[model samples]
Target: EAAVTQSPRNKVTVTGGNVTLSCRQTNSHNYMYWYRQDTGHGLRLIHYSYGAGNLQIGDVPDGYKATRTTQEDFFLLLELASPSQTSLYFCASSPPDGSNERLFFGHGTKLSVL
Candidate 1:
């Protein structure tokens, strides 16, 4: 089974503050992703990576950045956080490159910006 872990679980920040969400997947997969969930947006990908030193900007990459440090580690950065950026963040990993790639997601991190 694939396992993905995210740190802090929850976060609270003021407008213009900075936040960093951390994620680690331990399934030896080749794809990792960061996404944000909101009432209207649903689950929107912010950033993703396939392997170490491989980073891909996702659909909603305006206010986020990500880095993959190793096969099991990935980090998401929210440098200039804002109230509109508040949402539930998730980390997901998919199986190795193949036909039936399944994505498994972490619990989530609830971020509230005031």
Candidate 2:
């Protein structure tokens, strides 16, 4: 089975602070993505990486950065957080190895910036 897990499922921060969300996939997926889900809006891509040490900026990359240190792990960083950045973030993986070819998502991390 394909499984993606995230840490710090909930977070609260000040208007200008730093927050980190971590995700790991047991399936060794090659493509991983970070996205924030807002009310009544579709999932907005924050960042993505094809493999370790490769970062791909996405639509909502502002105020956010990402790192892929290992084939199984992806992390999202919010350097200077804001209330606007407060939302539910999800991590997903698309291994594409015919084992877990579909996008599998983590439960999500709920972030709130005051």
Candidate 3:
């Protein structure tokens, strides 16, 4: 079975604060992604990694960064964050390659900035 889990399900931060969201997958998948889900824009990819120590830039990598320390762990880092970056952040994992298949998402980390 495949599963993704995130810490601090909810967060409230002041603008320009530092935040870190952690993710872990049990499937040992090689593909991991970080995305933010907004009201109507749907899920926008942030950063992804193909394997440990390997990072791939995505459509929305600005204002955010990612690190894949292990096959089962990935982390999203937000430095100098702003209100615009506030959204429901999700972490996902897929098979070795993005097989044009569905992604397994974490419960989500709801972030609010003020």
How many clashes would you count in candidate 2?
0
**Superposition TM-score, candidate 3 onto the true structure:** 0.94
Cα-lDDT of candidate 2: 0.93
Model 3 residue runs over 4 Å out of place are 98-100
* lDDT-superior candidate, 1 or 3: 3
**Model 2 CA deviation exceeding 4 Å by range:** 97-101
Over 4 Å off, model 1: none
Question: lDDT tens digits, residues 50-111, model 3?
Answer: 89999999998989988999999999999888999989999999886546466888999999
Of models 1 and 2, which has the larger TM-score? 1
Candidate number that wins on lDDT, 1 or 2: 2
What residue pairs clash in candidate 3, if any at all? none
Q: At residue 6, what lDDT does model 1 achieve?
A: 96
Worst 10 residues of 1 by lDDT: 95-104
lDDT of each residue in 12-82, candidate 2, tens digit only: 99988999899999977899999999999889999999899999999989999999999999999999999
TM-score of 2: 0.94
Measured by C-alpha RMSD in angstroms, how accurate is candidate 3? Answer: 1.4
- Per-residue error at 8 for model 2, in Å? 0.7
Better candidate number, 2 or 3, judged by lDDT: 2
Candidate 1: clashing pairs of residues: none
